[model samples]
Target: MAEIAVLGAQGQLGRQFLAVLGRRARGLGRAELDLGDADAIERTLRRLRPQVVINAAAFNDVDGAELRRQQALAVNAEGPAELARLARTLGYRLVHFSTDYVFGGDRLRRPRRESDAPAPVNFYGYSKLLGEEAVLGAGAAALVVRVAHLYGGPSWSAGRANLVERFLARARAGQPLVITRGQTLNPTSVRDLVPAVLALLRRRSAGLYHLTGSGPCAAAEFAREACRHAGLCAKIQWISRDPRPARRARYTPLANQRWSQEGLPPMPHWRSSLAEYLLSAQNLPIRD
Candidate 1:
């Protein structure tokens, strides 16, 4: 059995873990391991018997969740609860990913700490919040890391492309970009997040932690910065709100208070990580 097992291997973040963890880790995508299937999850894990299980799978469509509540709940809430149960019985550490959407009522623009009460505004956020509660309350060895605006990872599907990739593609194609304005988030880099997670595992850290880039910015501003770094000039139209049916919080910057207090390495500013990713070989084939 591999030392580590990563579920959701086909996802952007999951792919990063598979790539970074290399041979020591085994990846199980939806085809290999379905989170919604409790028996399958238990049977598979019992066979692998990995020392650590990292759950990266989730029904992440914020607006889509409004229409498909059951699908979202099954994958995001119920599935995680089962994983937590197995982690305790099987005696393996579990690392689960969560989101900033859990604190939807934060209109005051304060950086939310782990201790802050969660008030999800949309079904997607609500489902994830449920998952967080289930995992943490299960009395299992688990790490629930809440992140925001993840970028700089391999997109498993065309629709899964992150903010940085979307902006870069549009800019390279000489297309004007339309971005939301009021929503603020810490645009985290998968590259940076992967290492921080590894550090937490090395230290055997558990419980809830907000793991995101150092600071936050408006979505429009983040797009502009991405274009600037790529030496691309593109017209950007900003809108006050997203036209989607789902309600989104205007300000939800997650503060890495627990991570910092634990003496973990400080996460780089969002801009610094963005620049590094845009300039790196991962983002190549620049036209013009």
Candidate 2:
């Protein structure tokens, strides 16, 4: 087992990485490894020095990011930049996860590619975009995997309210579930994601890759599928993306031709991934 160091190991997405990597990897949460402390991050990376560092950390609250611009920039932008720089210096391969928000949704028809121009609509997007630039600029042996609509965490991730979790809770409570029929994304599940990320590191495929689920779907369609999978009967209320106060990418679905060019298999459809996600969530051991 190649020793891998995972920053933000306690976070929802970070924990998914831990689960996939298991006990073979050294998992460091914020307490154990602080991103704000560059010296600490570098010192630890150099001394314990894992072969690969997977950065799942990000300041991702879209609305909250608008209110706290500096905070978002620090974590989403500066932190990854610092880590990637340190990784290059210390000779550790870096696998950094970025987001779809990097692209502003002006051209919904044209699927955003690795080369598409990024025009972030909000502070969160801007910060994440900055992080992407930072990592790429570091010019380390890196694989920047961009994904969207993520679900499956070590924790239930109630606060984030990912598609499956939101729909399941609503159906369980018999609450009306209204989703944005206007906004679109290919839901990328953690199960499929973690494996692909690990595989990428092995291949040493260094560049930007659009690793989303097989295709795109509106939020409403995702909700309906979630309801069906979870065996819940809730009246799905459909709404447009415009009704939401936040400015989101209207239709910036990513194209996956890069995956083909790299000769990697297409990720399983969102529906298949979601079914597995729901099953695993249900079978989770009871937490204290």
Candidate 3:
């Protein structure tokens, strides 16, 4: 069996990766280890000495990160740089997760390929882009998989704000969900993502890749689909604004042909995967 180490085991992506790769790797969360201190992270990796290392930890609060840019950079950029350097020195393969936010400023019509020039808009995107830069600069064996709008877990995880939580928040209160119809991207599911990441571990393909849902849709359509899955029959009122508060990428749905050419499957369309998430969540207690 291949020995692997997973950081951020408590996160949506990390937890999903662990559930999908159970009994096949070693995992750690902030409780067991922290990524803030680069030296500590390196020490943990050195001690484990795993063949594959997955770094899922990140400063993910997009709005909050605007105020705490340095902290975001520390975890997303500086910390990963240290891990990449150490991984290169130790002769181990590394895998890092980034976000679609990396290309928000560019309002392009075509699907953003892995080769597109990165021009991040917000502090969060800037930080993640820096992390990608660090990973490449290390010159180690690593793959940076960029994903968007992931929503799923082993259970009905109802905290820290996911797309599911946002949907549920509106549904339970019988309120109108005013979602943007202009924005578009691959709204990925964590279930689809974890499996692909595990597949990469088996092969360790080193390159930048898009690992997202099959198709792109507006947030309005996505919200309606989510409500349908939640056993709710609520009608949402679509609203248009002059300029949205968030610096959203007009249309950055990713193309995953690269991963497909290597025989790895792309994430299923958001609707299919989301239906599975809601049905599975029926048993878990619905938060009021």
Candidate 4:
């Protein structure tokens, strides 16, 4: 068995983790491991007996979760809970990823700390919050990382692209982009996040932690920055409200306070990381 096992291997963050870990890790995609199947998860982990199990799989359709609550709960909440239990029984460390949507309806506009009380405004956030509680509540060595607006790596399964990629794609195609204005978050890159996660694993850090890019910005601002960095000019149509049915948190910038106190390396600012990502994304038709 490999030292590390990464679930959701086809995902943006999962792919990055596998690339970084190389031969030390074994990747399990949806066909090999289904998050909704508890018994299958147990059987797979028991057989693999990996020293570490990283659950990067999640039902991330924020708006779709409102319609498919059961699917969301099963994948996001119940799945992690089972993994946490197995980690204790199987003697493997578990690392679970969560989201910033776990914080909403907060009057405070600052970046949320690990100690902040979560008040998820949507079903997706609520489900992830339940997952975090379960993993941390289970008496196992687990690290629950809350990230926001992830934006590096290749397109995810089903051709779903990250925010930065979406913006760059549209800008390159000479299409006008319509983005929301009020919603804010720290646009984290999977490139930076994968290393930080490895560092946390090295430290054997347990419980909850917030890991994201340094700077926070609105969706429109993030899009504009992506275009600028890619050296593309495109018209942006900014709207004040989200047209989607699911409600989003207005200000949910996660602060890496605990990671900082642990003496981990600081994440780069969103702009710098965005610039680096655009430069590295050679497949995209990035203009000079």
Per-candidate TM-scores read 0.96, 0.91, 0.91, 0.95
Candidates by lDDT, descending order = 1, 4, 3, 2
Decide which is better by lDDT, 2 or 4.
4
Tens digit of per-residue lDDT, candidate 4, span 38-152: 9999999999999999999999999999999999999999999999999999999999999999989748988999998899999999999999999999999999999999978
Model 1, runs deviating above 4 Å: 156-159
Error of 3 at 136 (Å): 1.6
lDDT of 3 by residue, 151-237 (tens): 776434625667766777778788887665576767888878887877876786787888998888777678777776666655666
Task: Write the residue-wise lDDT of candidate 1 on 70-176 in tens digits.
Answer: 99999999999999999999999999999999988855678999999999999999999999999999999999999998987878253578988888888888898
Error of 2 at 247 (Å): 1.7
> Which of candidates 1 and 2 is the stronger one according to lDDT?
1
Ranking according to TM-score, highest score first: 1, 4, 2, 3
Q: State how far residue 111 of model 3 sits from its true place (Å).
A: 1.5
Which 10 consecutive positions of candidate 1 have the poorest summed lDDT?
Answer: 152-161
Q: Count the backbone clashes (under 3 Å) in each candidate.
A: 0, 0, 0, 0
